[model samples]
Target: MTSISIRSNIQTEIREFLKLAIPLASAQVAQATTGFVDAVMMGWLGQEVLAAGGLATMIFMAMMMTGIGIISGVSPLVAEAYGAKQNRRVGQITRQGLWIALLLAIPGMMIIANLDGLMHQFGQAENIVTLADTYLNVMAWGLFPAIAFAVLRGCIVSLSEARPVMFIVVTATGFNIIGNYVLAFGKLGFPEMGIAGLAVASICAHWIMFLSLLGYMVWHKALRQYSLFKTLHRLEPKTMQQLLWVGGPIGITTLLEYGLFTTLTFFMGALGTPVLAAHQIVLQTLTVIYMVPLAMSYAATVRVGQWFGQRDWQQVRQAAFVSIGLAVMFLIVAAIALFTHSRQIIGLYLNLNDPANANVLNIGVSLMTVAAFGQVLDGVQRTANGVLQGLQDTRIPMLLGTFSYWGVGLTTSYFLGFHTDLAGTGIWLGSYIGIATAAIAFIWRFRGILSKKESRHPINGLTFKE
Candidate 1:
């Protein structure tokens, strides 16, 4: 343990963590940039469009994350298999992951098809509801492709070959932008569809990204040896159960967190259009910065899983610590930047000079400060969860997430935003409270697990179980 904690060993682990995380982060950033582009374009269509598009996107993402989160079960499973040199198990897990993605799509598409009713129930305006519904209908076509891509991505990251994933997403980002432009303006002989065009562009991006990665995984000489295409038609029941058992909780956990954010839209919608728009812009900024830590969390899952699979408890703990530390440090800098550039950052989403945009811009700038502070805690919790997932201990964290994000966090936001002077800021503050609690609980859980495992297994005689 002392040797593993020394400066050189720690530095090596840090390097390994970054090696996996940076490209993964870049891929995440590219995907997020697609949404940022959507937000920027929505801004071009005016405040109503921005607000409506933001609302629609929030709903779409909540659905997408729910499915993808379940499919993400492949990540840690593949990592453990790869670590233990179980090539056949890796292939089986990856294939079953794809199956889970396909199955989840049925429900996801149904949810998309019914969003109008949901939006109406939330009491959204007629025009806003109409616009959001139209956007979601087109975006629904991308659901399976998007979820399938998640499975492919999980497999690749666990293989410790993430550069190709970044490549695919960066390419998709370009395609999305160009497609949005051509279809939105009726360029390249396409009929102008405006908002629907953006939705179409996004669908194209998802399908292309998924297909391209699938082709790479199948055809690439190095990767193809595993025969990922070997069992395409057969469904293994046990494999499916493994994926669902692990992934269902992950999916629900993701939904709990994402749904919390989604619920805030209703609160802002109740407050008025300006508040909603402001919240959306602030959300965009938060999403962009979040990719780094999100990537770190993913990297942590892989690195920690590898060590755990090898039964190297010391390295497992070291990997977990370094990943969390790096994410926190990076986000601290991001927080400082967010605080300093609040006005400038808000300007990217709305025109600060335009008197018409003043209210939304001011609200956004204020929320940016809160998001900046919250970002650090968010980094901690997310990366900590990654560590737990790597160790294949997800169910308890799921329970904790339910309590933290909903029981404590959501309850706090409801009171602060509706019953106090905080309003939008209160909502943001409340979400962070939930995030902070998750971070603390998750870290504590990690330490306790390590201590318990150490007592029972000792340093030299250790075996990890999922």
Candidate 2:
């Protein structure tokens, strides 16, 4: 390649990468903020309420992520089609994703609405079970709005338009926080419904987010040039099948990841209310900080998928590197903040009036410090996984995740915490081991794929038979 050709390619890759990354980062920030807001609001309701909110949130995550995972298949496919300049296919996949989301939400909402009986089956403290059930049932109605928003947002990702989704999420999260204040504390002449109030605020916020995204898609002229409106009439069965194939693994992958945490929560409840409460606080904090890496992963997925569609493997590699590098740097900063001020951060969520409950706050700070490095690794693995997914290399990473989370991680935690003297800290150790293993395996798999592909020159496109 000529010097100029090489320079041009580098510049184009950088520009494309940034075009995808900045918006994804913004969306990630909004997503992270939503978790932080949920925790902060719930924190105000005392230890029991905080614990209840956390448990309920886990169930919500499991249900939502399961369906959203399926819908996530739309992004890479859309990104690939957009890169290939296939306007009709982009529209078709987006439409199919929406339909799938609608169908998925029905069962999701039903499960949430009826989760109380299931919580009892898990065999938890009666009080904890009641609280979890109450919060889940009320919040179950949120599935529709949440799924709708994901469907629309996935379309935006396909088009590489991240800013609008970010705006919609940030605005809705802001309103949700305000609603939390009003509903949770009986402010503005409202009843102080505590955990239930938080659920109500969430449902209202999701509806707002859904409506806002739908409106933007309908009205934005700049977006219309991409044939987003005109191409909606065409739908192809083969293309729909491709969407399902790509999305199915992703849905299962997300369920596997979220399910690990939910299962952990179930176990935590059996340990005691104190441990459960402490874990919730730390989890909330972790979730907030996790948005940075999560955003980077999404960026990697979009950029990698697009480059793959364009048959630009070098650009895909560069995109993955840049995304991972940025994520590492971001998490390093978050780690420092956590390590230096763990106690202070925990204090913000702790109820000082209840001195007897100080153990919860103290344990949270200590456990969070132990969990910090793992969080950094988590950023890496997730972002790397996204890159692989973007390249349509999902099977290996999915298998890796399943093994790491279930085989290595959860099992280690059980053995260490119950069988040994590590107690709660041992549980966190399991996550670290699991994720670290996943990170190594994912990186190796991705690198191996890249190497094999490079050895076979003149390969023009990626073709997955299934």
Candidate 3:
């Protein structure tokens, strides 16, 4: 291809990526915005309330990501099937996904319902443990809808119809925030429910999002042709097994990554409420930044899977590389913005003018600086993993991810946070190495797979088995 033609093709690919990525990112942003709303409202309650709420949120995230990661396998499967014009197979895959979502909800709810003892085991104060337990107890009720929402979302986004997902989620998030303010603050003659009210708002928000997407699937002319709800009770043992095989590693990897943050929260909880509250502020900011690339990765997963399904190896490579490049560039700029706006961003989550918040704000600024310096690699790892998911190449990536996060990141976090004076900041700095390591390993793995394909080599070296 001529240089001009190559540039045009690259530009075309970028536009395609952003078209899918932006809406997915918007949905994620809306979702994370609800977290921001919760954080700010918790801040209004008190430092201890904020601290307990933050811990509860992290644990909920860990549970939620585990289920979502597993269901995410359906996205690539649906993309490949749809791209190959197998509409019936797409329906089957989605049905299996919903079944998996329902099954996951059972154990997940049980765990969330009984976390009070676990909080006590962590040596948290009685009040903090009680508040966190109250939050999780209510949030457990929303877990199934959230998981089902992930399945429906993946199917739609795979079909390149992410706008509805974004619209429904944004609308639901608006409902969630409004509900939070009115119920938590007793704004409408409703008794203030505090943290429990926030959880109730989250529950209603997820149900709204779930039902909206489900309704769209039922009523929308284009999607209705797939008969997604037909045979909803049918069992597809092989398909469910495939999803589990491909997605089990994904769930474990998700657990590992979120598990890191959850553990860090425990460390912060031990340090005191001020440190925990500050950690929540910076972590929430980082989540907003991370959601952009995370959404881009999911978009790349759909695109690359479609290309792979069509047996277009070169297009697959192009789509993935463009996504990685876009994500990294965005995060590099985001890191700069975080560096400059550390105080202002923290101010959004906590009270800056209050003398009571001074220590939390100061800790938050320091943690924000640490995050700003380290988050670029996060983009690289997420997009690279997305490529692997597209190829159904997740098992080895899981191992590499576990080693990087636990072996390198969590280990360093513990030693640096407790064994030295660097404290919480050192813990944050260690994550940079972990993210970079995963980026290098995952990128290396994908490059190897691509090289094998480009060279017309045997498929024996494929990262995962069929």
Candidate 4:
């Protein structure tokens, strides 16, 4: 291609990526707002509530990650089918994805219901364990609906119809905030349920979002031709197997990443109440920012999968590069914002003026400083993971994550927090190193894959068979 043609192509790819990415990023931010709202509301309750709720949330997230990862298979599959103009396959994949969601939910609910023993095993304080258990019991009911919504979202986003999902999520977030106020604090004549009330509100919000998306898929004019409801009763063994083959690795990858963070939460709990509370504040703040790159990653997966299906090697490379470039640029901006306003950000989570919370506030501020430094690498790794998923290259990425997060990251965290004076700072620094390692590995993998010549049957070659 001539220089001008190449420049034009690059411009076109960037425009297309942004069109899909902006709405998706907004939806991610809206979805994350539910958790942010939860933390903020819980923070107002008391330090104990904040710490206990944070622990419970981590467990809930870890469990949900597996389901989200499994359901993630739907996006790539549907996107590829849509690109190939195989509309029937898209419907089939989406339906099976729902079944997978339901299947995953059963065990998830069971585990959370029996979480008391597990939390005790983790050596959490007795009172905090009881509070967390209370929260988890009610929150467990939301798992099925939440995972089901995720599957629907995957299908919709893959088709580049993300606006409805974004609308529903934002609406659900608003609903959740209102519910938290009414149920948690006895507003509008409702009985106050404390942490349990938050869980109840979350459950209600999950079901609402799920139902709203389901209705849209069934009635939306753009999705009408897919006939998504036609094969509701039929079970396709091959397709289900395909989803597991693709989604299982993704689930494991998510588990590994979330597990690392959850483990860090455990380490913080061991340090002290002040340290744990501070850790929660820092984590919540960073998670909200992380949503930006996370959304771009999802967009990258959809865009790359579509290009891959069409056997458009040049566009695939363009999409991958464009997505990564956009994610890094956004992260750079976010990191600077976080670094410059570290104290102000932490102040949102705690009362900085209160003497009792001084230690927590100070620790939180310091952790945010470390978080700012690592934000760019965090965005890079997450976006790279998305790019690889778009190409259906999952297993190797999973392996790389395992080594980086567990082997290097967690080990370093343990040594520093337990064996050295750095303590919490040391642990936070470990995450930076781990993320940087994964980022480098994932980017290398994407470039290696992109450089390969396209095969006649690209999908067959890249994807695993049942």
Candidate 5:
């Protein structure tokens, strides 16, 4: 191609790239907005309520990540199928994921609902246990909808219909905020239910989002082929096995990653209420800022899977490199914004003027500065990991996460926080190290996978068979 022609094609490719990526980014932004609203509304309730809400969220997120990980497995498969023009298989995998989601949610909801009572058996203080329990029970109501939404979301993202998901998520998050205001604080005529109200608002928002996605799927023509409402053949053992094989490790992998953070939060709770509240403030900020790279990762997964389907390895390399470049650029800018606004952002989460929360506000501000760079590495590694998932190289990633989170992240945190004096901030530092290690390992593995001189067996898409 001529230079001008090449530039024109590059521009076209970039636009095409953003077309899918923007919606995915919006969808992630909406997800983060839910937590922002939660924190904002809870801010009106003082540090205790905010701390309680934060604890509840950590517990809920850990459970949600484990359950939702099952659906992530479907994305690469669906993306590859779409790229290969295997429309029927996409529908089939979606069906299987739906069933799996239903099955997974039942147990997940029950486990989280009763987690508090179980925690107290270790002889914890009555107050913290009671608060955590109340939050868990109320949040449990949303579990089914959340899991179902995750499966539907995976199917849609694979089809590159990311825009509609953004619409639903934004709309739902808006309603969630409104509900938090009216119910959590007794705005207008509604009775204030405190933490329970927060829970109710989140639950209602989950259902609304799920129904909205369902409605969109029924009407969208581009998605007609992958509709979940259609009368398809009965469950196939092989299909379920295929999905389970891919999805099982993903679910386990997520549980390992999220579980480590959840454990860290639990340890933070032991430090003091102020520390726990500070951790929550930092976690919410990380989730929001991290979404950009997360969206970039999803885009990478789709593009890579599509290229893999086409057997066009060259395009696959281009897509991976391009996506990583975009993610790095975006996160660097985000890190700068985060560092500059660290104090102001912490102020928003805590009432800086309040006399009772002087300690909480100071600790949160300090942690934000420490957390800023951590999120950048988080973005880098996660997007790189997503690229590997797209290439269907998951086993090693799973091993890395397991070893890094538990062996490196958690172990280092314990030594630094307890053995030394870094405290909760040290825990986050360990997380940075853990993810950085995974990033190096994942990038190396991706290079190795692409550089193999011969075709490998198709089972794991690697040179080795399971």
Candidate 6:
């Protein structure tokens, strides 16, 4: 092709990626706002409460990602089926996904409810453990609803109907804020429940998001034709197996990444309350910014899945490259902002002037400074993982993630934090290496996949065979 043609194609690809990515990214930010809302509101309660809440939130997210990984199978399946014009198959996959969500929730609730023993085993302080236990016990009930919402979201997002999800998420953010205020502080005729109240608000928000999205899917003109609700009670072994095949690795991958951070939380907790609190603040801030690349990855999965379904290898590669480029560019900007204004950002989460909070504030600023270097790599790895998911190639990525995060990241963190004087800073530095390793591996894997000849046969009803 001529230079003009190549330039035009690049522009078109960028536009396509942005069209899907922008709304999805906004929705992700809105979803992340729940955590931000909890962190900030809990911060108002006190650093101890904030630390406990943050620890509980990280554990909750770790479990939540498991169910999310399982249900994520819906995206590529629905996207490919939709692209292939197999409307009935799309509906079947979604219905089965709900079953998977419900099944996962049972054990999830149990695990969360019984986290008290586990936290103690990890050497967490009794006070923080008590508060975290209270938080998890109440928040556990929300797991099923949250997983259900994720399933529906996967279907909607794969079909490229992300705006409604964004709308509901924005609405839920408002409800969460109101609910947190009234319940956590004894306003609106409710008893003040402290950290537990925050958990309750999160549960309420999850249910609202689930119900709203379900209602929209039922009523939406374009979506009604798929009849996602028609076979909700039925279970297909083949469909379930397919979902597991794709989703199990995704779950493992999520665990690999989340487990690393969760383990770091434990390490921070071991250091003391101030260090733990600082870690939470920096983590929450980075998570919010991380949503941009996360959303782009989701978009990549949808776009690549659809293009693969249509046997358009060129467009699939185009979508992958474009997504990676956008993720890198966005994260570069975020890294700059974080690096330049570390104290300013931490100040938003803590009262820097308060003597009690000074240590937490200083530690948080330092962590954020270290975090700035990793943001770009984090984006790249997350985007590459998303593209691979779209291509329906997950097992290798899972292996890579395991090695990078656990073998390289955690081992380094332990040696640095415990065996050396770097302490929390050492842990953060180790995370940088782990994430960069995963990013490099994923990008290499994706490029290799793109360079190979395209096969005509479909892989798992989603991707083309290698």
lDDT of each residue in 1-466, candidate 2, tens digit only: 8999978876776677677667766766676666677777767666677777788899998899888887788889888988888877776777777778777898888888887777778767677777778888888889888877887887787687878888888888788878888888899999998878888988998899888988898898876755554555555567667777887787888888889889888777767778888888788888877876887787788888887788776777778787888788888888888888887777777765578768787677768888777799898889898988897887777888999989998999888777887777788888789888888998898898877765664366755433
Question: Each candidate's TM vs. the true structure?
Answer: 0.97, 0.93, 0.97, 0.97, 0.93, 0.97
Query: Higher-TM-score candidate among 2 and 3?
Result: 3
After TM-score superposition, the amount by which residue 379's alpha carbon in candidate 5 deviates from its true location, in angstroms, is: 0.7
- The lDDT for every candidate, in the order shown, is 0.89, 0.80, 0.90, 0.88, 0.80, 0.89
- What's model 3's overall lDDT? 0.90
Model 1 poorest 10 in a row by lDDT: 457-466
- Clashes in predicted model 4: 0
Off by over 4 Å in 3: 457-466
Tens digits of per-residue lDDT, candidate 1, 1-466, equal 3765687889999988889999999999989998998998888888988898999999999999999888778889889889988888888988888888888898889888788887878878888898898899999999999999999999988999999999999999999989988887689899988889999999999999999999999888888757787978899999889888878888999999899999988888888899999999989878988999999999999998888778787788999999999998999999999999899877887778899999998788788889988989999999999999998888889999999999989999989999999999998899889989999999999999877776777665355452
Q: How accurate is candidate 6 locally (lDDT)?
A: 0.89
Clashing pairs in 5: none
Off by over 4 Å in 4: 454-466
Residue pairs with clashing backbones, model 6: none
How does candidate 5 fare on TM-score? Answer: 0.93
Candidate 4 lDDT = 0.88
lDDT by residue (125-222, candidate 4, tens digit) is 88889889999999999999989998998899899887887888889989998998899999999999999999999999999999999999998887
Clashes of each: 0, 0, 0, 0, 0, 0
Model 3 residue 116 lDDT? 87
Clashing pairs in 4: none
lDDT of 6 by residue, 335-355 (tens): 999999998888878888889
2 or 6, which is superior by lDDT? 6
